[model samples]
Target chain A: MALLEVKGLSINFGGLHAVDDFSIKIEKGELYGLIGPNGAGKTTFFNLITGVYKPTSGTILLDGKDITGKNTIQINKAGIARTFQNIRLFKELSVLDNVKAGLHNRYKYSTAEGIFRLPRFFKTEKAMDEEALRLLKVFDLDDEASVKASNLPYGKQRKLEIARALATKPKLLLLDEPAAGMNPHETAELMETIRFVRDNFDMTILLIEHDMSLVSVVCEKLSVLNFGQLLCEGETSTVLSNPEVITAYLGE
Target chain B: MKTKSKLIKPYTKKSFITYALLIAVFTIVQLILNFGKMSFMMQSLLVPLCVYSILAVSLNLTVGILGELSLGQAGFMCIGAYSGALFSSLMKEAIPEAMVRFPIAILLGGLCAALFGVLIGIPVLRLRGDYLAIVTLAFGEIIKNICASLYLGKDAEGFHLSIKSAADMNMAPDGKMIINGALGLNGTPKDSNFTVAFIILLITVIIAYNFVYSRTGRAVMSIRDNRIAAESVGLNITKYKLITFGLTAFLAGVAGVIYSHNFSTLQASKFDYNMSILILVFVVLGGIGSIRGSVIAAVVLTLIPELLRETIGNYRMLFYAVILIAMMLVTSNSKLKGRITAYTNKLKGLIKKEKKGEIK
Candidate 1:
């Protein structure tokens, strides 16, 4: 059974159909890539699935449960987490805290317990701190744990954003151009980290990437989009070779 | 290491020391005033000190942590002040003991304000930045005007609302006045004292501190830091925002209750937009998201005007303007900020060195 299945998902922002009739199915632990030219509605598709913009029509099923128009937090709890193309790190927060924010849904301590400094607050807090540090270490950001997120270098900030997303422990991870602002060296390292996470965490990943090199290396299958509609989807080599996909996406 | 985990702020040794020093000064000053070391003018400012402290700290949670502007905080306070004063007065003949009645009134005031928070926060949270500020400011004006026109009285015919003044409030011959229109609520018992206000302030600080370090605090801060990022992480933005705004309103209400009970007569005019703006100045000058800074700012700023009135005399407004501009210049100056940070770090290093020496 597919881990995620979207059927006829559509959204129109005012007069423009930003994302139209988007549908895809991915098995658990699959590595999928979303590739399209500029203004091709790739990010909009991610937005619709994550409930940032309410879809005008369609159903999104995660593990066979329908999750249409749920609030971002609820959709997150339902096992979908994402990163931004612009690298939205909590600028004022400590590096550790940036990741710890994602673990917010995992705690069971009540607000009263938190305010009162109950043992449960300490127990869970320590666990979260350890977990956040562990994830930061995976991205080699443990050394910068105490630094303000905005003070980190650009590549490290991108790594921190991904680390923060992973702290939520989602079954499905979405990346919106994670390699957009990196040098070749940095992009290579990020691709290695992405591959490592997909395999080690045993989770599904769908990334909208403009970097064809990173996509070709990491993705097992690819979906091509053009003007809010899917043009073609197949194994990476096959889709890359399709004349229609070439004209619509890569040919640019 | 143990000390780091013992408190909400793990590495803020300087702020911790500053907070301790200010709290000690507050207690010492109160004791000295009680001993009649200060004039009546100085002594009377104590209650206002605590009230403004509560107001500043709670408002910081909204402006600093929640990243939403609110100017109707004083409106919530008005609701609390009237509700609390009314509850205490009605319970007076029955409860008798000031101790029993006052606590209940404070809680009721908080709950009442929280109720208003729910009613106002839902629509207001949808608006952001400057627009949100304008709406809250309008709410403050609207609430004050409505209270000015409202009249409440209790008698054998139960409670009644009258806009034609309290004297004409149609009630039994033995009716008791709750609020007398523009004249405001009168004859409420003065059960609030400096000690009670101080205790409430401490509790407010503790709760705010704990909240800033908790998981919920992280979620709330994330919303302020980046709304899109927070939502995409699966945080219900509205739910967290409502909870934060509600809690801040509740604290402001408690402060209002304390202020109302500290005096016998209360007026809606006291909680105007100017008052809201004054408290915001305390928050911004203290350093946004710095709980300890808010407390110190509240106390120091409240004391400044009174202190200046005696020292600077008729040139008070001019002095205040100069001082405010100077502060802004120094705080906003990058070189000055760097120097201040470097100096504080040096002080911290000295303290750590002292601790090591003691261990040896």
Candidate 2:
């Protein structure tokens, strides 16, 4: 069974169909790529899958379980997480704290325990801190753990966002414009990190990217989107070379 | 070297030491003021200082940490004061010991305020920034208006409510009116003391400090930083907002109980729009998210009039306006704020070094 199955997904903003009749089947452990030009509904499709926007009509299934129409947080708890096109870290918070926010759900303690300084609360908190620090180390941000997330450089901030997402332990990870502002060196590093994350965490990944070099490094399958419809989907080399996709989107 | 994350865990030694220092300082000041035969004005300022400090810390949870603007703190305070006052009044004959009665009254006050908190929070949670502030302001006005005209009387027949006067109400002659129109609650019990007020303030500080170090508190702060990102990470934004707001009201209500019991007479009109704004001022001036800052701001602001004495009477209004503007400027200006933070960090480092020497 496919890990994620979208059937006839559609999202309409007034008269405009921002994402229309989008469907795909992604198997577990596969690295999927989504690419398109500006205003071609690439982000709209992502918004739909992550439950940020309520699709005007569609059904989204994860491991054959229908996940359609759930709110963003609920969908996330059901094992889907995403990074933003623009990095969204808790700007004033410590890097470690930004990651710890994701690990909050892993423990079961009441507010009373928090207020009263219960032993269980302390135990869970210490463990959460360790895990959060470990995640920061993975992104090479451990040294900056105590620094405010906003104070980090642009590339580090992007890396912190991904680190924060991984703290949620999602079975499915979505990367939206992860390499938007990176130099080639950082882009190369991010590609390797993406592959490492999939292999190490054993999770499915779907990334939206304009950096074809980065995409080709990690993504095994590619789906071309243009004008709210799927232009084509196939193995990476074939889809990237499709003449129709080239003229409509990839050419420019 | 990575320092362990202090987010939402239990009390660490560092935080514990800070809290202990605060308590010690407050206790010493209270003792000196008590034993030094302080002037009546100074003595009078103590309770208000504690009460307002409690209010500031509670309001800070919503404004600074949760990043929501609330102008309805006075409404919650008024509810707490009345309900707490009602509890003491009704228990006057039954409970001879004021000590036994105060806790019950405070708890009842906290619960009543939380009830209103939930009621208002349900709708207010959907709003952000200016809209939320306006709606809360409206609610504060509504509570004030209701209290101004609300007349409740107790008789052999039961409780009766009338808008105009207690005389026209269908009740026995022995019946007494608890609230008079525009007069507010008549003759609430005077059972509060400086010691009790100090203890309550300390408790508020502890709970607030611990809350900021809790998992739920971390979630709430995350929402403040970035709602979409907080949500994307599976944090329940609404639940955390509601919880913080409700707890905020609970603490404000406790402050109300402390305030009302200190005086023989209570007026709902005292907790009007200005009261909420005053508390917000303390929160902002104290460095919004800092509990210690809130405590200091509340104390300093409460004592300003007394400290200025004779000149305060002539320039009281102007002085407050100018002071408030200056405080806002200091907080908002990046350079000024940076200097203050740097100075404080240097002082903190010195203190830590001295402490280490002591241990050695």
Q: TM-score for each prediction?
A: 0.91, 0.94
Candidate with the greatest TM-score versus the true structure: 2
Query: Per-residue lDDT of B1-360 in model 2, one digit per residue for the tens?
Result: 226633422236546765887789777877787698677877777788889989999999999999999999999998898889988987888997998999999999999999999889998889999999999989988887887887888988999888777676776889888887688776777878788888898899889988987888889999999999999999998889999999999999999998999998888889899999999989989988988888888888877766766565867767877887888888899999899999999999999999999999
Sorted into a CAPRI-style docking class, model 1 comes out as: medium
* lDDT by residue for model 2 (A23-47), tens: 9989999999998888889888888
Least well predicted 10-residue stretch by lDDT in candidate 2 chain A: A243-252
Candidate 1's C-alpha runs over 4 A off are: A10-22, A56-58, A247-252, B1-19, B156-158, B335-360
> Mind giving the per-residue lDDT tens digits that candidate 1 earns over B204-315?
9888878877888888999899988988776778888998899899999999899999889998889899899988988988888888788888887888778899988989
| Reference interface contacts recovered per candidate | 0.62, 0.78
Stretches off by above 4 angstroms in model 2 are A250-252, B5-14, B335-360
Model 1: which residue pairs collide? A73-B234, A73-B235
